[model samples]
Target: MNMKEANKKAVEIILKGQPTLVGIGKALDVIPGMKEDIFLHAGPPITWERMSGPLKGAIIGGLIYEGKATNQAEAEKIAESNGIKFAPCHHHDTVGPMAGVVTPSMPVFIMENKTFGNKSYCTLNEGLGKVLRYGAFSDEVIDRLKWMEKTLAPVLKEGLKIYGGEMNIKNLIAQALLMGDEGHNRNKGGTSLFIREIAPSLIRSSFDRESVAKVIEFIHSNDHFFLNLTMPAAKCIIQAAEGIKGCSILTTMARNGTDFGIRVSSMPDKWFVGKAQDVDGLYFPGYSLKDANPDIGDSVITETAGFGGFAMAAAPAIVQFVGGTPKDAIRMTLEMYEICEGENDTFKIPALNFKGSPTGIDLAKIIETGILPSINTGIAHKDPGIGQVGAGLVKPPRNCFEEAFEEFVNSMEKELSNE
Candidate 1:
């Protein structure tokens, strides 16, 4: 097919996706190709030596959680010794936020794109602050992970089984946009909706009332709890567009602490990479910009699917965390439309008069318009074990998109040569 026809098919496949929160299961069981020795992280792949501090810290935490190491020093030693393997979550049809580390023993949510029959995985969210995803490898972090594996995962799994129906994630996202959540950075509405859908099954489950209450209370308390769910949900939606010949829209945008990378539909296996950029936004008291690490996370997948930052106009209240005025949020959404292939009919924005979110990021348009996708993310501290210090907006370095544009031109040239 011509590029235009391919892009049209890609956009339709992506927008037609219906991701559902199927259930939860152990990482080794639910995640495709997961193994006891492999450590899956958030962004494009990197090795131990090249990994950032937070990424390193999360590995340490993952090691302890997996019983691969007894303490931080042991974890570090094994990591440097190459006693374990490392890979990106995206490579396994999974996605993670921030430090995005997943060990064999952790619990993960299974998301299925019913329309396309593809599945994606992501670990449950550990509410913000000193969480493993942010690279905090302290005792508290390990303990919290253990609790999630032992309690939260099982509760949710049973609840989903009892509920026995697909949790229509696309509809939830649509409703969330109307309720002022952009499906990343700010997910209060989505989390609330998730709870509403599952609370009944959770209550009816055989688990003790106390455990049920704790799970419900825990989810209720953490607004970002839904971030993990949305990450894989977005991945499930976007992956439907992968491998369409001549399609130029992006299917992946992610960051390992060390690099920012993107994959386009036409070149699904190749990652165009650049230096990860630093974030600019408000910081917690006593933590200045100096404490912030460069942008990190698979959460940007939300933006790739066309909501997160691309739908900022629908979540103006998000400015409270990402440091922008309401007008800036609207403008960000407007600017995004110029670089995207189309609007997401299901993920509509109320502020834009119920217009769909800018979807299917077109690499050609980004280079042509000189616009980078805007991502609002939590800021990890520069040092290992420091966790999150702030929240803010960031842009992947321009060089990545430039590289993607080069790939696009070369692809066209190759096709013409063949013709």
Candidate 2:
């Protein structure tokens, strides 16, 4: 089949499936291991050695929260001694931001794309700066995680239950784009829309008024709460296109502290990998370039599938962190359209005159165009123990995609001969 035909088939398959985390886990065939008492943020089973600082910090904080360890040092030793197994959220067909850590006790969002019956999963955004995803593991971070476990998750679960059924992430994402959210790096509009959707159920849930209030406060305070929504949305889209024969669409992109791995639509289940790229962006107070970690996490699947840094025109505020002017952001979004298969009509961008955001990256086009996908990511301190120290812009090395394409061509040749 030709590229257009392959692209169309891939989109059809993706749209046919509903996105769910468990479904993604089943699809990817990996179950993230979680501390029986501690909660994780994303994906199936990970080991401590495979974890980045932020992930490690999140893990240590989780140990303390579970009373499994008394302090960071103790938690570190326990993790090193094989007490914990590191896994990628993507391994479980899930995604997470920054450290992308997930524990059993944490509340995870489950998105089902009803159309295709597939699902995607991710942890809720923990607001910004010094939060767990950024790699800060401290009493304060642990305390916040406790509050989310004890208060926020329960109430949100109750509220969502009352609403009943999967949230329509596609529609929310479309609206968010128009309202000024890139759906990654910047989530202002998406968060507001998410609040509006769950507010009524939240008000009626059996959780006490204070509990509901706290949930509201948390969502309102974290401009990126809707990030959880976008992650599943991307998962929904990417999974929809999986398993298409002869297709070269990228199915996954994730980091495991030490390396970044990718899977393509054509290759179905094989992983193509490279070293994680370093992030170069603005820093929080008391942090600098010296402290940033290389890019990590399965969250890049969102951008690769369309809508993260690729849709930056919708969230120019991202410029402050990732180093780009508003014009550059718009250009980036527009440039992505050149390499993608089509526009995601559901996710419209007002800045682009209400045009749909670019969607479905085409690996062939990327190779032909020589344009690597753009990503906005949090920077972890290089030292595994320092955790997240900043945020910025980076690109996956072109070689990974190039290698996947080469293998895809070889596979195609073999199939042709068999025919």
Candidate 3:
């Protein structure tokens, strides 16, 4: 098939994907290829020597959580000594936000692409502030992690079972867009929709009233609770489009706080990387642009699946948190259309007159339009343990897309020569 035919086939596969929240389980139990000493991180793979501050901090936290080290010093020693293995979550059919660290014992949300039978995994969101995902490994962070593993995971697991089976994540995301969530940095609507679906099951389960209430309260208090759910859902959607030979569709976009990376459908496992860019937007008090780390997270998976930044037009209020005018948000969504191959049929945006959000990012179009994919992301503190400093907009470096396009052209030329 020609490149254009291959691209159309890739887009068709992505559009037909149906991502569902199948269940929740421990990372070791649910994620394929997870091992006791293996720690999965965000973005493309990098070594301890080259890891950015936030990524390093997260690794230390993971070591402590896994009981491989007793303290930060010991954790650092283990990390530096090669006692632990580091791999990107993407390498293992998983994704994590920010530092995106996942240890064996951590609870992960499980999503399955009903159309393709592929499953994706992502850890539960830690509910903001001083969490390990942002490079914070304080006692509070550790305690919260423990509570999630011991308390939250079980409750949610039971709740899913009680509700009969997998929840359709794509449907929730569709309703969320109408309710004002773009399913990325702003997930208030999505969280509420999720709670609504699961609350009844929690109440009917064997758990006591107080325990159920506590679980509901925890979810209610965290607006981004749906983020973890949506992330794996997005992964399932994008992975469904994978392995389309000769297609130039972008299947992944992620950051490791130090570098931004992209993977194309045609290229499969090959990662095209560029330096991570600093976010340009509002900051919390006492923080400035200098205090912010470069954009980081596996959350960009949401955009790769075609909602997050691409649905900015659907959630105008998101600009208040991410720093942009409503017009800018709409413009970003409209501009994305120039580079994407199609619109998502299931994940529609209400504000765009019920139009579908732009989907299927095309590398050739990106190079042609000179437009990088826009991302709305959380800004971590430059120093480990300082937590989130701000939220804002960033774009993957132009060089990454350009490089992928060049590789695509080379492969296509070789194919033609063989013909």
Candidate 4:
């Protein structure tokens, strides 16, 4: 097929299955493998020394949560001895945020893209700062995980059931755009909108008065909670678009606990990768660049699909995280529009005077601009055993796309010759 045909097919696949949450008790509420007792990690597998601070903490916490070991020291021995297999959530068709691992039994969010009828899953947000998603696994973090599983997940699951159909994420994303949420790294508005849509059902669910209070409090307190939902929603949407021949749409972005990689629609299972960059952003007290590690996780796909650092202008408040001026936010989002295929009429940005948000990174345009995609990410300490220590902005190495493009061109030529 011609390049135009390939692009059209790719767009078709992307539009086919956008995802949404529809039920209670899905795995989304639980951390990775919380219920299964088998915790999984992000990207490809690596040795213990390669793990970041937050990732290490997450592993230790997973051990604690799973009753695999009594303490961090024991957990380290167990992990090194191969008592627990090291596999990527991506291998399971799932994505984890930092050292993302899901033990079975944890309530997980289940998102379905009705158009393509495909599904994707992820665990709930751990409420930031020394939490599992950021690679922290402290006692405090462990306790919070327990509370989320035992209390928050059940209540929200019941509440979510009141809306029997999928949450219309496409529409929600559109609304969030106008409200100053780029969906990733800055989901304040999107989180609020999500709570509002699910609130009616949540109220109707059988949560006790105290549970209701707790759920309400939790939702109000954590701005990133909705990020959990958005990740799966975006995952479900993009996964639906995978596997269209000649369609150069990106289907995945992941770090194998070592390297950052991406997959395209046409190259379904093949990976085009770049060295993961270190994060450069604000850090919690007692943490600095010295403690940071290369970028890790499956969440970068959110930005790749549009709305993380790319849509920063919609969420100028994000400047505090990545340390850029308000103008930089606008420029970032604007630049993304140049690489993307079209504007999402549904997701509008008031900062851009109601301009539709950018959607679908266009390979052709990306090649033309010579600007690699921008992402806001958390930083893990280079040393294994330490978890996340900071957060910052990063751009995918250009060589990745350059290599992929050359291969794609060669593949097309082969097709022409065969024809």
Query: Root-mean-square deviation of each candidate, in angstroms?
Result: 0.8, 3.4, 1.0, 2.9
The superposed Cα distance between candidate 1 and the true structure at residue 400, in angstroms, equals 1.2
Question: Of 1 and 2, which scores higher on TM-score?
Answer: 1
State TM-scores per candidate: 0.99, 0.90, 0.98, 0.90
Q: Model 2 residue 13 lDDT? A: 63
Best-matching candidate per lDDT: 1
Model 3: lDDT equals 0.90
lDDT of 1 by residue, 295-378 (tens): 999999999998998999999888878899899999999999999889888999999999999999999888888988999999
Candidate 1, residue 100: Cα displacement in angstroms equals 0.5
- What is the RMSD, in Å, between candidate 2 and the native fold over all Cα? 3.4
Regions more than 4 Å wrong, model 2: 1-4, 15-47, 383-388
| Candidate 3, superposed: residue stretches over 4 Å from native | none
Writing each residue's lDDT as its tens digit, candidate 2 over 1-419 gives 86468877876665444443231121112234444533444322445666666677777776676677889899888888867565566656567877777766566777766777666677767777667776677777778877877777777777777776446677777677777678777788878987898899889999888889888988999887888778877887788788887777777777754567778887767877777777768887898876776777667777867788888888877777677789988888898888877776566677888786777778888889998888887677755335556667888877788998888888888987887
TM-score-based ranking, best first?
1, 3, 4, 2
lDDT of 4 by residue, 164-183 (tens): 65677767776776776777
Model 1, residue 57: displacement in angstroms?
0.6
lDDT of 3 by residue, 1-419 (tens): 87899888988888888989889989988799999889999999999998888888888888887778878899999999999899999999999999999999999999999999999999988888788999988888888898889888898999999998789998999899998889999899999999999999999988879878988999999999999988999999999888787898999999998889999998889999999998988898999999888989899999999999899999988898899999999899999999999988888877778889999999989898888899999889988777888899998888888888898899879987998
Candidate 4 error regions (>4 Å): 24-38, 44-49, 380-389
Model 4 Cα shift for residue 105 (angstroms): 2.2
